[model samples]
Target: MPATRALVLAAAVICLAAAGWLVLREATDPGLAAHPVPGMGEMNAAELSRDGYLVIPAMLREVYVAFGATEEAVIHDTLAAVAAGPALETLYLDRAGAMAGGGLDGADQEIHEMELLDLASSRDGAMLSVNATWRVLGTVGHAEHMHVRGNVYSAALTLAPTAAGWRITGFELLDVDRSDAGTMVAAPEPAEATGG
Candidate 1:
Protein backbone atom coordinates (compact mmCIF):
# COMPACT_ATOMS: atom_id res chain seq x y z
CA MET A 1 0.00 0.00 0.00
CA PRO A 2 2.84 2.41 0.87
CA ALA A 3 4.60 1.55 -2.40
CA THR A 4 1.37 2.15 -4.32
CA ARG A 5 0.97 5.57 -2.70
CA ALA A 6 4.57 6.50 -3.55
CA LEU A 7 4.07 5.50 -7.19
CA VAL A 8 0.89 7.57 -7.45
CA LEU A 9 2.63 10.59 -5.91
CA ALA A 10 5.51 10.28 -8.37
CA ALA A 11 3.14 10.12 -11.31
CA ALA A 12 1.27 13.19 -10.10
CA VAL A 13 4.50 15.12 -9.63
CA ILE A 14 5.65 14.24 -13.16
CA CYS A 15 2.37 15.35 -14.70
CA LEU A 16 2.49 18.64 -12.82
CA ALA A 17 6.06 19.28 -13.95
CA ALA A 18 5.15 18.59 -17.60
CA ALA A 19 2.19 20.96 -17.41
CA GLY A 20 4.38 23.64 -15.88
CA TRP A 21 6.94 23.24 -18.62
CA LEU A 22 4.30 23.65 -21.28
CA VAL A 23 3.04 26.82 -19.65
CA LEU A 24 6.53 28.23 -19.46
CA ARG A 25 7.17 27.42 -23.09
CA GLU A 26 4.02 29.12 -24.26
CA ALA A 27 4.74 32.22 -22.21
CA THR A 28 8.15 32.59 -23.74
CA ASP A 29 7.18 31.80 -27.28
CA PRO A 30 7.19 35.04 -29.25
CA GLY A 31 4.72 33.75 -31.83
CA LEU A 32 2.18 32.57 -29.29
CA ALA A 33 2.80 35.39 -26.82
CA ALA A 34 1.78 37.99 -29.36
CA HIS A 35 -0.68 35.93 -31.37
CA PRO A 36 -3.77 37.89 -32.25
CA VAL A 37 -7.32 36.76 -32.03
CA PRO A 38 -8.27 34.78 -35.13
CA GLY A 39 -11.09 36.27 -37.11
CA MET A 40 -12.56 36.76 -40.57
CA GLY A 41 -10.66 39.75 -42.01
CA GLU A 42 -7.34 41.50 -41.64
CA MET A 43 -5.89 42.01 -38.19
CA ASN A 44 -5.96 45.66 -37.08
CA ALA A 45 -3.07 47.90 -35.98
CA ALA A 46 -3.31 46.91 -32.36
CA GLU A 47 -3.04 43.29 -33.32
CA LEU A 48 -0.14 43.95 -35.65
CA SER A 49 1.70 45.84 -32.95
CA ARG A 50 1.31 42.91 -30.68
CA ASP A 51 2.61 40.46 -33.26
CA GLY A 52 4.05 42.05 -36.40
CA TYR A 53 6.32 39.08 -37.01
CA LEU A 54 3.39 36.75 -37.43
CA VAL A 55 0.93 39.08 -39.19
CA ILE A 56 3.11 40.93 -41.69
CA PRO A 57 4.28 37.88 -43.63
CA ALA A 58 0.78 36.58 -44.14
CA MET A 59 -0.34 40.02 -45.22
CA LEU A 60 2.43 40.20 -47.79
CA ARG A 61 1.46 36.85 -49.23
CA GLU A 62 -2.09 38.08 -49.80
CA VAL A 63 -0.84 41.21 -51.52
CA TYR A 64 1.45 39.21 -53.79
CA VAL A 65 -1.37 36.88 -54.86
CA ALA A 66 -3.74 39.79 -55.38
CA PHE A 67 -1.30 41.38 -57.81
CA GLY A 68 -1.68 38.41 -60.16
CA ALA A 69 -5.44 38.78 -60.39
CA THR A 70 -6.50 39.64 -63.96
CA GLU A 71 -9.49 41.73 -63.03
CA GLU A 72 -8.75 45.41 -62.53
CA ALA A 73 -11.36 45.56 -59.84
CA VAL A 74 -9.67 42.78 -57.96
CA ILE A 75 -6.33 44.46 -58.29
CA HIS A 76 -7.57 47.86 -57.17
CA ASP A 77 -9.83 46.64 -54.43
CA THR A 78 -7.32 44.22 -53.02
CA LEU A 79 -4.56 46.79 -52.95
CA ALA A 80 -6.79 49.44 -51.49
CA ALA A 81 -7.96 47.08 -48.80
CA VAL A 82 -4.47 46.13 -47.70
CA ALA A 83 -2.69 49.43 -48.03
CA ALA A 84 -3.16 53.15 -47.46
CA GLY A 85 -1.30 56.49 -47.76
CA PRO A 86 1.87 56.32 -49.87
CA ALA A 87 1.75 52.58 -50.10
CA LEU A 88 -1.63 52.61 -51.82
CA GLU A 89 -0.53 55.27 -54.28
CA THR A 90 2.57 53.29 -55.12
CA LEU A 91 0.61 50.13 -55.79
CA TYR A 92 -1.77 51.92 -58.12
CA LEU A 93 0.85 53.89 -59.97
CA ASP A 94 3.67 51.37 -60.16
CA ARG A 95 2.49 47.81 -59.76
CA ALA A 96 -1.15 47.57 -60.87
CA GLY A 97 -0.74 50.22 -63.54
CA ALA A 98 2.57 48.85 -64.82
CA MET A 99 1.10 45.64 -66.15
CA ALA A 100 2.22 44.94 -69.69
CA GLY A 101 -0.08 45.47 -72.67
CA GLY A 102 -2.43 42.70 -71.52
CA GLY A 103 -1.85 42.80 -67.77
CA LEU A 104 -1.37 39.63 -65.76
CA ASP A 105 -4.32 37.94 -67.44
CA GLY A 106 -3.45 34.41 -66.47
CA ALA A 107 -0.57 35.14 -64.16
CA ASP A 108 -0.38 33.35 -60.86
CA GLN A 109 2.07 34.03 -58.01
CA GLU A 110 3.15 31.58 -55.36
CA ILE A 111 5.20 32.46 -52.29
CA HIS A 112 7.39 29.48 -51.56
CA GLU A 113 8.89 30.98 -48.41
CA MET A 114 8.89 34.22 -46.45
CA GLU A 115 10.92 35.33 -43.46
CA LEU A 116 10.83 38.47 -41.35
CA LEU A 117 14.38 39.63 -41.47
CA ASP A 118 14.06 42.70 -39.28
CA LEU A 119 11.53 44.79 -37.41
CA ALA A 120 11.60 48.23 -35.83
CA SER A 121 8.67 49.57 -33.90
CA SER A 122 7.73 52.91 -32.36
CA ARG A 123 4.76 54.29 -30.53
CA ASP A 124 3.05 55.40 -33.71
CA GLY A 125 4.23 52.92 -36.36
CA ALA A 126 6.51 50.06 -37.32
CA MET A 127 8.86 48.97 -40.12
CA LEU A 128 9.74 45.54 -41.42
CA SER A 129 12.28 44.04 -43.79
CA VAL A 130 11.26 40.71 -45.31
CA ASN A 131 12.85 38.19 -47.64
CA ALA A 132 10.73 35.93 -49.78
CA THR A 133 11.10 33.20 -52.40
CA TRP A 134 8.34 33.28 -54.97
CA ARG A 135 7.36 32.27 -58.50
CA VAL A 136 4.95 33.31 -61.20
CA LEU A 137 3.23 30.88 -63.58
CA GLY A 138 0.97 31.30 -66.65
CA THR A 139 0.68 33.90 -69.38
CA VAL A 140 1.12 37.49 -68.18
CA GLY A 141 1.00 38.90 -71.67
CA HIS A 142 1.32 37.91 -75.30
CA ALA A 143 4.84 36.43 -75.63
CA GLU A 144 5.47 37.68 -72.12
CA HIS A 145 4.38 34.72 -70.07
CA MET A 146 6.11 34.27 -66.71
CA HIS A 147 7.57 30.92 -65.67
CA VAL A 148 10.07 31.89 -63.06
CA ARG A 149 10.56 29.71 -60.02
CA GLY A 150 12.75 30.15 -56.92
CA ASN A 151 13.06 33.89 -57.56
CA VAL A 152 13.99 35.73 -54.39
CA TYR A 153 13.56 39.31 -53.19
CA SER A 154 13.76 41.44 -50.09
CA ALA A 155 11.30 44.23 -49.27
CA ALA A 156 11.20 47.07 -46.76
CA LEU A 157 7.77 48.08 -45.53
CA THR A 158 6.28 50.73 -43.27
CA LEU A 159 3.11 50.28 -41.29
CA ALA A 160 0.96 52.88 -39.61
CA PRO A 161 -1.80 52.63 -37.08
CA THR A 162 -5.35 52.87 -38.41
CA ALA A 163 -8.86 52.34 -37.15
CA ALA A 164 -9.30 49.27 -39.33
CA GLY A 165 -5.95 47.74 -38.43
CA TRP A 166 -2.31 48.29 -39.22
CA ARG A 167 -2.26 49.32 -42.90
CA ILE A 168 0.79 49.32 -45.10
CA THR A 169 1.86 52.92 -45.52
CA GLY A 170 5.09 52.58 -47.49
CA PHE A 171 6.99 49.97 -49.50
CA GLU A 172 10.37 49.62 -51.19
CA LEU A 173 11.93 46.69 -53.04
CA LEU A 174 15.48 46.30 -51.78
CA ASP A 175 16.88 43.49 -53.99
CA VAL A 176 16.06 40.65 -56.35
CA ASP A 177 17.58 37.37 -57.54
CA ARG A 178 15.97 36.00 -60.69
CA SER A 179 16.08 32.39 -61.77
CA ASP A 180 18.40 31.50 -64.68
CA ALA A 181 15.51 30.22 -66.75
CA GLY A 182 13.16 33.04 -65.87
CA THR A 183 11.23 34.33 -68.87
CA MET A 184 9.10 37.20 -67.64
CA VAL A 185 10.16 37.42 -64.02
CA ALA A 186 7.75 39.04 -61.60
CA ALA A 187 9.04 40.32 -58.27
CA PRO A 188 7.21 41.41 -55.14
CA GLU A 189 7.38 45.18 -55.38
CA PRO A 190 6.71 47.53 -52.45
CA ALA A 191 3.57 50.05 -51.94
CA GLU A 192 4.62 49.78 -55.04
CA ALA A 193 2.95 46.42 -54.11
CA THR A 194 -2.87 40.35 -48.12
CA GLY A 195 -5.01 38.37 -46.21
CA GLY A 196 -8.62 38.19 -45.16
Candidate 2:
Protein backbone atom coordinates (compact mmCIF):
# COMPACT_ATOMS: atom_id res chain seq x y z
CA MET A 1 0.00 0.00 0.00
CA PRO A 2 2.87 2.45 0.71
CA ALA A 3 4.45 1.67 -2.69
CA THR A 4 1.14 2.30 -4.47
CA ARG A 5 0.71 5.61 -2.62
CA ALA A 6 4.20 6.70 -3.70
CA LEU A 7 3.42 5.84 -7.35
CA VAL A 8 0.24 7.93 -7.33
CA LEU A 9 2.05 10.91 -5.76
CA ALA A 10 4.77 10.72 -8.49
CA ALA A 11 2.13 10.74 -11.22
CA ALA A 12 0.44 13.77 -9.70
CA VAL A 13 3.74 15.63 -9.47
CA ILE A 14 4.49 14.85 -13.12
CA CYS A 15 1.08 16.12 -14.19
CA LEU A 16 1.56 19.33 -12.22
CA ALA A 17 4.98 19.93 -13.85
CA ALA A 18 3.50 19.42 -17.35
CA ALA A 19 0.72 21.88 -16.66
CA GLY A 20 3.20 24.45 -15.39
CA TRP A 21 5.37 24.04 -18.50
CA LEU A 22 2.42 24.65 -20.77
CA VAL A 23 1.49 27.78 -18.87
CA LEU A 24 5.05 29.10 -19.09
CA ARG A 25 5.16 28.39 -22.80
CA GLU A 26 1.97 30.30 -23.44
CA ALA A 27 3.34 33.21 -21.46
CA THR A 28 6.65 33.38 -23.36
CA ASP A 29 5.81 32.33 -26.89
CA PRO A 30 4.96 35.24 -29.17
CA GLY A 31 2.63 33.06 -31.25
CA LEU A 32 0.49 32.51 -28.18
CA ALA A 33 0.90 35.97 -26.67
CA ALA A 34 -2.39 37.33 -27.90
CA HIS A 35 -5.15 35.62 -25.99
CA PRO A 36 -7.99 35.13 -28.39
CA VAL A 37 -11.40 36.27 -27.27
CA PRO A 38 -14.24 33.80 -27.17
CA GLY A 39 -15.61 33.13 -30.68
CA MET A 40 -12.75 35.13 -32.23
CA GLY A 41 -10.94 31.88 -33.01
CA GLU A 42 -7.20 31.94 -33.73
CA MET A 43 -6.99 35.39 -35.26
CA ASN A 44 -5.46 38.03 -32.99
CA ALA A 45 -5.44 41.81 -33.13
CA ALA A 46 -2.02 42.07 -34.76
CA GLU A 47 -2.94 39.58 -37.44
CA LEU A 48 -6.14 41.48 -38.10
CA SER A 49 -4.22 44.75 -38.39
CA ARG A 50 -1.72 43.32 -40.84
CA ASP A 51 -4.40 41.69 -42.94
CA GLY A 52 -6.34 44.93 -42.97
CA TYR A 53 -3.35 46.85 -44.29
CA LEU A 54 -2.66 44.28 -46.99
CA VAL A 55 -6.10 43.46 -48.34
CA ILE A 56 -7.94 46.79 -48.48
CA PRO A 57 -5.70 48.37 -51.13
CA ALA A 58 -5.79 45.43 -53.49
CA MET A 59 -9.56 45.28 -53.19
CA LEU A 60 -9.80 49.01 -53.84
CA ARG A 61 -7.76 48.76 -57.01
CA GLU A 62 -9.96 45.95 -58.20
CA VAL A 63 -13.06 48.04 -57.59
CA TYR A 64 -11.55 51.09 -59.22
CA VAL A 65 -10.68 49.50 -62.56
CA ALA A 66 -13.62 47.14 -62.68
CA PHE A 67 -15.83 48.64 -65.43
CA GLY A 68 -18.85 47.12 -67.08
CA ALA A 69 -22.07 48.02 -68.94
CA THR A 70 -23.19 49.98 -65.88
CA GLU A 71 -21.79 50.87 -62.49
CA GLU A 72 -24.35 48.60 -60.84
CA ALA A 73 -22.44 45.39 -61.49
CA VAL A 74 -19.10 46.84 -60.45
CA ILE A 75 -20.57 48.39 -57.33
CA HIS A 76 -22.30 45.18 -56.36
CA ASP A 77 -19.16 43.13 -56.91
CA THR A 78 -17.00 45.56 -54.96
CA LEU A 79 -19.41 45.71 -52.04
CA ALA A 80 -19.52 41.93 -52.03
CA ALA A 81 -15.76 41.53 -52.20
CA VAL A 82 -14.87 43.98 -49.43
CA ALA A 83 -18.07 43.90 -47.43
CA ALA A 84 -17.65 47.62 -46.81
CA GLY A 85 -19.71 49.29 -44.12
CA PRO A 86 -22.45 51.85 -44.74
CA ALA A 87 -20.10 54.82 -44.33
CA LEU A 88 -17.85 53.38 -47.01
CA GLU A 89 -20.75 52.96 -49.40
CA THR A 90 -21.28 56.71 -49.36
CA LEU A 91 -17.65 57.31 -50.10
CA TYR A 92 -17.74 54.75 -52.89
CA LEU A 93 -20.66 56.44 -54.54
CA ASP A 94 -18.93 59.80 -54.28
CA ARG A 95 -15.62 58.58 -55.64
CA ALA A 96 -16.77 56.13 -58.31
CA GLY A 97 -19.84 58.23 -59.31
CA ALA A 98 -20.32 55.68 -62.10
CA MET A 99 -22.93 54.19 -59.81
CA ALA A 100 -24.93 57.35 -60.33
CA GLY A 101 -25.00 57.06 -64.15
CA GLY A 102 -21.59 58.64 -64.66
CA GLY A 103 -20.08 55.97 -66.91
CA LEU A 104 -20.30 55.94 -70.70
CA ASP A 105 -21.16 52.82 -72.67
CA GLY A 106 -18.12 50.93 -74.03
CA ALA A 107 -16.08 52.67 -71.36
CA ASP A 108 -13.29 50.66 -69.75
CA GLN A 109 -10.30 51.44 -67.57
CA GLU A 110 -6.88 49.82 -67.23
CA ILE A 111 -4.80 50.24 -64.09
CA HIS A 112 -1.21 50.73 -65.19
CA GLU A 113 0.18 50.86 -61.68
CA MET A 114 -0.77 50.72 -57.99
CA GLU A 115 1.26 51.47 -54.88
CA LEU A 116 0.68 51.48 -51.13
CA LEU A 117 2.11 54.65 -49.68
CA ASP A 118 1.28 54.23 -46.02
CA LEU A 119 -0.63 52.02 -43.58
CA ALA A 120 -1.55 52.38 -39.93
CA SER A 121 -3.95 50.88 -37.46
CA SER A 122 -5.74 51.81 -34.28
CA ARG A 123 -4.45 50.70 -30.90
CA ASP A 124 -7.18 48.09 -30.57
CA GLY A 125 -6.71 46.99 -34.18
CA ALA A 126 -10.31 47.96 -34.77
CA MET A 127 -9.43 50.51 -37.45
CA LEU A 128 -6.80 50.90 -40.17
CA SER A 129 -5.73 53.82 -42.32
CA VAL A 130 -4.20 53.38 -45.77
CA ASN A 131 -2.81 55.70 -48.40
CA ALA A 132 -2.27 54.59 -51.99
CA THR A 133 -1.75 55.76 -55.54
CA TRP A 134 -2.94 54.46 -58.89
CA ARG A 135 -2.19 55.18 -62.54
CA VAL A 136 -4.95 54.40 -65.01
CA LEU A 137 -6.16 54.86 -68.57
CA GLY A 138 -9.91 55.24 -69.09
CA THR A 139 -12.45 56.45 -71.60
CA VAL A 140 -13.58 60.10 -71.50
CA GLY A 141 -17.18 60.59 -72.56
CA HIS A 142 -17.63 62.14 -75.98
CA ALA A 143 -20.63 61.72 -78.26
CA GLU A 144 -19.00 60.91 -81.60
CA HIS A 145 -15.70 59.21 -80.78
CA MET A 146 -14.08 57.50 -77.85
CA HIS A 147 -11.39 59.39 -75.97
CA VAL A 148 -8.94 57.56 -73.75
CA ARG A 149 -7.35 59.64 -71.00
CA GLY A 150 -4.56 58.65 -68.70
CA ASN A 151 -4.54 59.97 -65.13
CA VAL A 152 -2.99 59.45 -61.73
CA TYR A 153 -4.81 59.51 -58.41
CA SER A 154 -4.09 59.16 -54.70
CA ALA A 155 -6.49 57.63 -52.19
CA ALA A 156 -6.85 57.28 -48.45
CA LEU A 157 -9.01 54.50 -47.04
CA THR A 158 -10.05 53.77 -43.49
CA LEU A 159 -10.94 50.23 -42.41
CA ALA A 160 -12.94 48.86 -39.54
CA PRO A 161 -12.77 45.38 -38.07
CA THR A 162 -15.97 43.34 -38.03
CA ALA A 163 -16.98 39.77 -37.31
CA ALA A 164 -16.63 39.13 -41.04
CA GLY A 165 -13.08 40.60 -41.00
CA TRP A 166 -11.72 44.03 -42.02
CA ARG A 167 -14.01 46.31 -43.98
CA ILE A 168 -13.54 49.74 -45.50
CA THR A 169 -15.28 52.43 -43.47
CA GLY A 170 -14.29 55.58 -45.30
CA PHE A 171 -12.33 56.79 -48.35
CA GLU A 172 -10.91 59.89 -50.03
CA LEU A 173 -9.10 60.50 -53.32
CA LEU A 174 -7.31 63.21 -55.29
CA ASP A 175 -7.07 63.08 -59.09
CA VAL A 176 -4.42 64.71 -61.27
CA ASP A 177 -4.54 65.00 -65.04
CA ARG A 178 -1.43 63.38 -66.51
CA SER A 179 -1.49 65.26 -69.81
CA ASP A 180 -1.05 68.61 -68.09
CA ALA A 181 2.40 67.68 -66.79
CA GLY A 182 3.49 66.06 -70.09
CA THR A 183 4.26 62.87 -68.17
CA MET A 184 1.58 60.73 -69.78
CA VAL A 185 3.40 58.84 -72.55
CA ALA A 186 2.81 55.89 -74.85
CA ALA A 187 -0.94 56.48 -74.84
CA PRO A 188 -3.08 56.61 -77.97
CA GLU A 189 -4.21 60.06 -79.06
CA PRO A 190 -7.84 61.02 -78.62
CA ALA A 191 -10.02 59.58 -81.39
CA GLU A 192 -11.85 62.87 -81.80
CA ALA A 193 -8.64 64.70 -82.63
CA THR A 194 -7.67 62.01 -85.13
CA GLY A 195 -11.24 61.94 -86.51
CA GLY A 196 -11.26 58.18 -86.02
> Each prediction's TM-score against the native?
0.53, 0.53
Q: Model 1, 10-120: lDDT tens per residue? A: 999999999999888756643223222223254434455556566666666667666767677787777766677888788766655656643555555554455555555
Per-residue lDDT value at 97 in model 1: 64
Q: Write the per-residue lDDT of candidate 2 for residues 1-196, one digit (tens) a residue.
A: 9999999999999999999998997666543344322233434445655564456456666566444335566656656455467645764555467545544555444444455545555533345566656555555443444445566667666655555555566666655547632232343466845889
Q: How many backbone clashes does candidate 2 have?
A: 0
Residue 60 CA displacement from its true place in model 2, Å: 1.4
Candidate 2 residues lying further than 4 Å off, grouped into runs, are 1-44, 51-53, 65-74, 99-103, 120-122, 133-152, 174-196
Off by over 4 Å in 1: 1-50, 101-104, 108-146, 179-196
Clashing pairs in 1: 44-165, 44-166, 45-165, 45-166, 59-194, 62-194, 190-193
How many clashes in each candidate? 7, 0
